[model samples]
Target chain A: MVVQNSKSNILIVEDEKGLRLGTQRLLEEEGYAVSAAENGNEGIKLGTSKEFDIAVIDLRMPDIDGLEVLKEIKNVYPNTVCFIATAFASYETAIQATRIGAYGYIPKPFTPEEFIYQIEQGIKQRELILSAERLKKEREENLFELASEKSRLNAIIKSINEGVLVLNKNGELAYYNYAALKYLNIREINIGENVIDKLPSKIVAVVKTIFSNDTFLLKTYTVQIEIKPNNELILEAACTPVPHPDGSLAGVVVTLGNITEFKKIEVIKSQFVSMVAHEMKTPLAAVQGFLNIIVDDTINVEKEKRKDYLKRSIVRLKSLTDLVNDLLDISRMELRTKHREIENIKVKDILSNVLQMLELEIKKKNITVQKNIEEKLPAIQADQNDITRIISNLLSNAIKYNKENGSIGIKLGSSPNYLILQISDTGIGMKPEERSKLFSEFYRIKNDRTRGISGTGLGLSIVKRIVESYHGKIEVDSQFEVGTTFTINLPINLN
Target chain B: MALIAIIDDDIDILDASSLVLKSKGHDIVTATNTTDGYKIVKERKPNLIILDVMMEEPDDGFYLAQKFRKDGIKIPILMYTSVSKAIGMEFDKSEIVPVDDFVEKPISPEELVEKVENLLHLKEVK
Candidate 1:
């Protein structure tokens, strides 16, 4: 289906006025869009202004000859069909004109039919060259579209996180991406090469299943496999058959997803569940044991001993209640930063309130307090209970861990960007190992020095979480024999 | 009355266990930690040892039990564990933990006595 563009534009160059005018009239009656020039210079100017489909030149001219005009006009529009007409048609000149891309020659003093015939042939030739150019341009555009589509497909495949691989029906490498190479532990691969051998056997097994001879069976297969056993690098490979519309085997597509982090999370969750079980059970067992001994019918238990067991059970149950409360506090902190009643509050006031609440305990231990709080301290945005909880937990620890007549020190001040509070106590601190695990949930120091000290082991964990939720930080520095100090830095003027 | 050594970190557990065994006409010797418990058992040569896997100390019970075996102390150790047996972390008789048996708490007074008597009888038979 070619466009037959019938209207053809023609240009003629001749110095003879009668012949130029006569030829123009003959071509104009033939329905050609004709333009005439007197000499080569005039022809060059007309050629620059208009693009003619066919160009006719007189071989022998006055000043600027036809050869120069043909060369100039052809340079402007390379597909211009150029021809020569002359009375003197020599062999060398003909060869030279043909060398410069002249289509053919027309002898001068020719008949009218001959002139019209040559013009018709040149129009036909011009149409042929234009159609040929249109076909070449269409083919090049189609090729460009194909190349871009392929590269775009390639870019999509490479950027995805899932490892992708495609194999042809013969189990040779059709396509693969960078993630596929890394996931399958492949060093080098080439297209059309057999990739079945390079893959790990677990994945290879799935690929074989897809490529199996059972033509009726079309089902996706998935397998969870450990790629590196020692380090526990694991993956899940999913393979599906790529089928043709004719119910024939085309290829297989395989996708791999990394699941090592999920596996580790499951293990940690189970461990935490067991720890919670153990913590809940230990105190309950003591309380149950206390009751069991008191209630055993076969034993002759005295009233005083029964009373002692009952009292001890109450104490153990109290600690159990504290454990439950602490657990609830931790879960609440984890569940949401929402539902908190936030306000601007002074740390100085909260610290004093906590101290007043703990007055009885502090006085019973004979612990003296030394306070160094800066006046006009900047207010911090936080939940009031959160601040109270932090101060109370740390202060109580100082009181509980301190000896008789021990001193508790408090220093609350503000730096340029942060409100810094440091609380220290003259008490038995911890070893390096103990301090490292101090903030871990359900961790407590257990040795001869800590034999009498009792705790739920969740205090410091809750405190650290509360401080961090407000974009603040808490640090602990403790020496085994000297003392323990806790420092907190809460950001000021932070929304 | 046979002298029995009980090692536990919880003073209440030690007290309850002492009361339970004392009702059985046994002289109870108690230590609140592994070190003192080991010294008391070695010096007093108690006929039976009750070892508690305390929550505060991680893996201290297994270490103490194995240490006793390595030191050639053949006293029958009745371990008290708060970890549930159904949780599938049962402490069985092995070279890693050479204890006589496990007693998942809270052991009823009758069951506690039963396990302690069985282990002591096994010691005597050996």
Candidate 2:
């Protein structure tokens, strides 16, 4: 649009020299910047060369028709308003001028006031055309920006991990990502199509629940569902209402997240609880038997035998307490493992500490443990308690399962990459099948040999976790009724 | 009829069971381990025997019960089933664990006495 407060440029063309000069003088006196041409050819040249807001062309020119000049001016600057000024104003000429993009024509030999009024109307028309063109361009720019933003959002939704589905108020799928299709296992889907029937029944139920509820616009509903009957894939859906500004529901947005791993962990957690219960029940039952006999009125016990029963009951109860503490230790070891103090530790110290702890058992079983160490043994970087647990559990097993006068051999050696600790016992050994299940949680050997041996059954499971956490290796070698050996290889450096 | 034997690895179970039977005016012979339990039962020929389900070996009582039947000693055997027995089976799955009667451990003193008297009375009728 032409800038306001600046003089509007005007152009006048005529075959008559006096008329062209007179019109120019009149427009100049009216505070307009004017340019005049004597013929149609000159007008075309001046019109194409400079910008003008309004043009007045005279018809019946000698060189060319005034309509030709107007056509050329309109082709160059479509926003410029053109007018036909003719001495003989006729019905045919006025219609032809209007078709050639002229605002209105002026008659020759008119008063200055009449001519000035026509000029004023042409200026207004020129401003309207320019303003329309500016508005159209601005609208096009805004539409382009909106298109780009929509594509950018589509790209993000398609790549995000969580599945997204947007449904219209009519329950037709308006927008969705590939993740949504994959999560739902929907093979064929199209825009603006109803896929509710294709959804799993649980999710469909959620949708129906949302659409049927009166307060749907005010709440978000969550549903946990398996993808299909007895299927491993689990999904969690959050159906949130997309509302209009007037507090009315426009559509429902469903976001789905895969929670199969989360469900598996829950199953493992329950299995762990039952295992604890099973292990605890046996000891508790045994302790109850002892206590029952001691308190019975009909059972008259001798004084010395009563003392023995009381002492044995207390011992069994103490072991039960120890089992509970051990369970807590195992749970704590599995969880809250973020903070741990790692430092250089001596295997020798750990072994000696374990030996001292199980000294009574070793002495009672008459087990002779021989320690063979390489000179100048290197220190292993590990948590001290973890190493102590491994040693004590294995050492106690060696003592508990050993036959009278059986020998236990300990060998500590170092290779280039590993610190090897091996403990061998001439004790009752496991069959290959029993050895295989040794590290399983709550799995104790159920045969005759292991019946006499009391244990919490979680020692080796904890040992395996610690070994795997440190990227170390543990191996068991056994021949039933012959002997068993346990080997551990701890890496010197951690990455 | 007064001679009764109880076999269990848990010394407290053996002592407690023997005390409960002895108070009922029965002579009690007890073995804390499986081998001695078998020896006492075979030698003494007790009228009825209470056997713990597990001793030095799991299923020691079951094996002893089978052995007693194989030896052609038909005196009633009271199986002292542990908690493990309740969840696994009540001597139902295996024909090998043949016994005349069953009593679960942490045994009610009254139940043990009642079971012993019933077995003796059943043996007299047989």
Candidate 3:
């Protein structure tokens, strides 16, 4: 700490002129920076202004006592090493010097060798003290820097969306961010605590594997962890080793990216694709079978049978065409939304049109239809085509799903702000779970009653989409084997 | 001639399959959905069953098969699935889906006949 080989400054305070000059000359000859003070006051003044690594003070002085001078020097520069020079070698005075922070004393009538040796000892002691002081200051500075850096890192991690955790060389949790805590559903994590003891086994397993294997280090790995019994949390974690100053592995820093949303979307996409394929395949299979039979001449099929098969093929083809058309309508619904052609349209007209379209099916099923429309019903502001589609889809579903001789009820009323249409059917209804997914694309209720009903499953989705676009709401009430009632509330006009 | 039951949601599929199976000199009974399909199987005691996977929903075929097993019905089941192969839904006779075999659809007339014959023969062995 003395900064090896740098000249150490020495202050000699003596009331006697001859001894002070001689001491200064001897120290100067030994390549030390020596300053001479005639009395205790001068020594205190010089010690306060310039830092002297060592101070040699006469025990008895005229102006100020040597003890007082030593005390003042130590107050200003506590690192300065002091020596007491006194001809009077009293036991009490020596004790006083030591109490005043004097390193040691040089006795009177000493040999030149003894005097030089004492001076050398004082300089060496000064170096040791200064070195220790430098080390202490450096240590304080390093600690302050480490604390500031840690807080800065914590601030950065807190602002990011991704969760992060760091483990030290001993596999203890060194740092963790807010997102990490929230992801793990923990309130607080203590530093230097082993994650295996604190975190769930799933995460502990992943972290343990990462630490035990060298190949996993510096590589980004992904794993799906079930943070709870049934809920799965997908995390993509990247681990990198923290290197020490000597280029050794100090710890591993792990960053976790939440990919649960992405996984959910992937599942939804696959299920939708499978549903669409299943929907399309039914009609395709029917058509293929009928066409295959009709084209097969080896089997002695009758003319009437051939005609019937062809007719059924045509029906399957027609449904296929309808499916394609519905698909197109759905695409149009996505793109041409919010571009409704506003016009004054009577709800009755759309209802009549839908009834006319379903006349053949309704009559075939012997279904009785009832209607209750408010007198002088005000025209709702909506696109005629959309209202027609909504009414037609609902009526079609009712007709399709109805029991023979089932009753269909239609009620229309108007409030100040809304045109309400309610349709209830005494038919085969749906399970409660199926009602929630009734509006999802390509979703169809699957049970014994619904098994025979043929539909593209896009009807209600289209109805929901179209109604919502018009700032309207559709509510359904149903019980299995009882009935289903759908209530539509459409805002009359845009304000 | 053996009695075979065909279960599907599409009337066209039921008609077409009945025509083909009956043409093979096999007596055929058909239902358009699982409820009537189950009733037909119970009453008719068909030697074999041709089931569609997506009639009531995606797992209708599997559900019906499990129901048959639960009721101690040991008829050979030939499932018709459009997405079973496309989505790589493996058919495990030993596990989740207990069926004799699977036939991806568009109803290849020849493949249907072949699988039916093989399944009926396999059932006869048991």
Candidate 4:
């Protein structure tokens, strides 16, 4: 085992040479490393520099007094223990030295045993003080580390993209990050504001439900809200409760995110599927009907008679092929793989061509057609093929679903910024529900069956998509069994 | 003789339709696509046009029907399609398929002749 050094380094400062020498000799014999100082000034200098465990100074010195020296040593080396050893020791002097941080005092004529005892007591007191100082330093370091960690957490909460809010136990806003402020369209800082009073009714209700329970727990609620001064902007937000450290009720922490775009995309996809199915069915049915005519031998009478059945079957078969091609076009457009050829085109020419194409069906139905395209209509810059497809689709649907001998009309005009095209037909109009989903892929009106009209249902969907890609808009007005009018607004100049 | 113009994209359908209409003791003109069908309609001026919804293109027949209306061509049209009855939708009396009548595909020979005769009578009455 290693032995601990009990001996301490002591400095004896006294003006009298004989007493100082005697005291130093006694301390050295007691296993202490002792140093000697002749005056108070020298004692103070030596005491400050050397790592002395204790100092023994005389009450009266030539340069500086013992109490003054004691004050200086205590101030400089607070941990170092001091003892007063003076020949002129009195009750008043001893009290003064002790008050100035002296550890112990011994009269000049004291015996060696008494002197050793006082020095031992001084060393013990110093050990206790040093241990206490080390503990306090460790506690201070821990407190600094905790404060830094809290600041880091606060910074992270503020930087997150999602809105974050913290409310106190009384449902008052305690903390709200920048994202939360923006999401709510709150211009001013709202800390300490009551959440129930400040937030909209829907959100306030959700919070109230979450915090109704006594025990602090994590709970989530969703609510719809309008942000900004504009009520048009809709947002879906989620609120959750945060618990306190003691497991008691703390404030609530809420996180909110926006999800408006997701809902619109889902509606478009469903409509596309239905239109494809409906369009394909019509041609397939015709093919089947023609096949039945050819197979039935009873119907055949002469060469000319037999030829009729074969000819009808062939017409239906060609229609099937056309339907397939149309489906392919739609697929390409949906994937955005097809690039449109843009050019300047005359609106009247396109409208006239479309009308000429439908002449046979119109005449057969005895439907009257009218055109109101102005002669001075300006040329529109657009993808000619896409515009043709758009106009053709609308006109076709109008005629295909119109009353026999009904009127079909077309109007074209141009304003400063836009080219307006309108097509109206005395066809079976659509209900509100049908109108809402008219632009959706594959959505057909419920009443088309009775009229025996056939469509792919992708017409309006394709038209809408093409118009949007060109940064234009389309609108429809229709009433059940009355008529339908489609209005297309296109930019005059392509940007 | 009663003249019927058959417009469809499929050569097979053109052949089959011609055979059916001819067998029914009616004169038939067939066009394999909407462009040719329109030409045939303008020249032949058939009493009735047998239009298919999908021909050379999905909406080709429908477009042809609208064109005829805009050009003031007044002829009775008979629209034939397979999916007409599948979706439970009916054509209104005044709509584009606003033909004298509509016939779903795979029709029997007897029904085809009967519908044709009835439409002819309806035309005479008007």
> Highest TM-score: which candidate?
1
Q: Report the lDDT tens digits of candidate 1 across residue range B1-126.
A: 678999988888888888889988889999877788889999999999999865346677888998898999988888888774545565588998788888888878999988888877777788
Work out the TM-score per prediction. Answer: 0.83, 0.75, 0.64, 0.51
Instruction: Indicate whether candidate 1 or candidate 4 has the larger DockQ.
Output: 1
TM-score comparison, 1 vs 4, better candidate? 1
Which residue runs of candidate 2 sit more than 4 Å off their true CA positions? A5-52, A55-66, A85-90, A107-116, A134-231, A235-257, A337-339, B1-22, B25-126
* C-alpha RMSD in Å of predicted model 3 compared with the true structure: 8.7
Q: Tens digit of lDDT per residue, candidate 3, span A55-102? A: 889988999999999999988988788888888988998898898788
Instruction: Assess each prediction's global lDDT (C-alpha) against the native.
Output: 0.86, 0.82, 0.82, 0.76
How much of the real interface does each model capture, measured as fnat? 0.66, 0.52, 0.77, 0.45
Error of 2 at A315 (Å): 3.1
- Checking candidate 2 for backbone clashes, the offending pairs are none
Query: Can you write out model 2's per-residue Cα lDDT over B5-114, one digit (the tens) per residue?
Result: 88876666766777777788999888876678889988999998888776545567788888888888887888876654434444552568778778876677888888
Candidate 2 local Cα displacement, residue A455, angstroms: 2.0
Comparison by lDDT, 1 against 2, better one: 1
* TM-score (chain A only) for the predictions, listed in order: 0.81, 0.80, 0.57, 0.55
Ranking according to TM-score, highest score first: 1, 2, 3, 4
